[model samples]
Target: MTIGVLVLIIISACSRVDGEMNRVERASGGSPIQVVTTIGMISDIVQEVGGTEVVVTGLMGPGVDPHLYKASQGDMKRLEDAEVIFYGGLHLEGKMTEILEKMENKKLTVAVSKDIDRAVLRSGKDAGGSQYDPHIWFDVKHWISATETIYDALVQYDPTNAEQYKKNAETYINKLTELDAEVKDRILEIPENDRILVTAHDAFGYFGEAYGMKVMGLQGISTASEYGSKDVSKLRDFLVENKIKAVFVESSIPTKSMEAVIAGAKEKGHSVNIGGELYSDSMGEPGSDADTYIEMVRHNVNTIVDALK
Candidate 1:
């Protein structure tokens, strides 16, 4: 395949997680709670809680890398009409960092992921080689906190539904708790020796921490980072030495690095398989099995368990 086509194939694997799809007219009526989020998963969570009460839109879509995304005319229209804007903060949206800052003063925009404890955030190489890793949704617990923050924002926007929002948040949190348990149980089914997780990017630190598995990615959390030859060689060594059964690719990032890893392992007389595509950066397209936040987590667990067990 041509490089572009290969990239498309990798991204299409993640098409399962692109939750914010082409606009659908939301249920008309009680009150329009316009919410603008950075990606589809957040939009899905807002819809789950806001129900038919909120109208939501997102700036990023399937295969659209958020680190490099630039808001277009359509985004401006969405922002102008929104009652509150919700984004995954901690530098997840790289280019729109400034836009999110400016919106803080004008709109009721909040970085819903801020509720996560700083200790849980992974650091970037700056400010003494430490900056927060912004992919907080990888862990269901952190997202549970984010859901609470979202509930507060929704209540703030439309207090009339405060009771309803709280109830919705509780319901969602319970589901997340169940998801957390399910993922752990599934990962436990993998033999202890095969519990290592290798992927295209380092977006699963929280997932590793939560599930008692080790995670290694060829690139950084953001797809903007190109996988270095050294990293790939190192990962190949790790996979071989540990006898890792499967190395997975992510839905959003290119899987060339993963292919390189698999090839390198084969060269050393160790065999490994590409487990399956994982939903990392975003959720699936609307109406697909992995579209919603809960479904996204469940599907990921099922895929991982099936492959690694």
Candidate 2:
């Protein structure tokens, strides 16, 4: 079905659930907030801060690309049932923006990165003239700020659990702070000249900015955009000239583009390898170390350092 039809169905379903929303509480007797998030990163923070007080469901899973994600019937049902919905905003969910905006009026829909300073956001080079990058979770410090945003939203939604949410936010933020320091130290092991992070797409602009690395991507910030021969040739030339040993692939994006770049570089006499698969738009699977936000960041950093250092 078309997105508009799906949205209409969801709107109809939401109206039906709106009346019964008051009857649903925490599975237990307490006031547990029902939360739905667009991406795993936001879901992790909500789960951490909400703890037992909230039942959080993430719409996107490991290796799921949010930019191309569409609202499924099941996803719409989940949104209809959820008391609050959180997303990464800034056009991250380009396909579902209109539907999400409509839901905001009916429920507590929030953009977790809404309050971030515009100065910190990377400008998009895509056709849209004024879009900003929405991958805020890459920078640990920005992710910490997002935790506060999540905390405040949770507190506001479930005032009874405000104190608990605050405590959880504090603990999670501290963990992120330590993670920030650890990532910096790890990156330092790599020589400054080798700090170029070439990837499948421009998802890591925030990461490169925060961690002192130069990031280049074959595709634009959003995976929805396509790369032409010129883009590949330019990136290939860059890798050849820099003698960069590695270019990484993203878990969410196809490796064909990076492979093409590597081949083009090889023809130009530069031997570049796939450094490792970085978690660009999504985390890893549940049993893996990169399943959680902290583990995902650590894994990406270790992969980069090991390959580039």
RMSD of each: 9.2, 2.5
Taking the tens digit of each residue's C-alpha lDDT, what string does model 2 give over 1-309? 666556656577656566345434422247667899999999999999999988889999998988888888888788877888899888888888777877776767899988899888888757133278888888998898889998988776677778888899999999999999999999999999889999998889999999999999999888888899999999999999989999999999888989999999999988999999999899999999899999999999999999999
lDDT of 1 by residue, 132-239 (tens): 877788888998888999998777667777788888888888998988888888898998877888888888888888889889888877767666789889999998
Runs in model 2 lying further than 4 Å from the true structure: 1-31, 127-130
Predict model 2's lDDT versus the native: 0.86
What stretches of model 1 exceed 4 Å from their correct place? Answer: 1-30, 126-130
Question: Per-model C-alpha lDDT, please?
Answer: 0.77, 0.86
lDDT of 2 at 21: 53
Backbone clashes counted, model 1: 7
What is the lDDT, from 0 to 100, of the residue 302 in candidate 1? 82
For every model shown, what is its TM-score relative to the native structure?
A: 0.87, 0.93
Q: What is the lDDT of residue 17 in candidate 2?
A: 68
Best by lDDT: 2
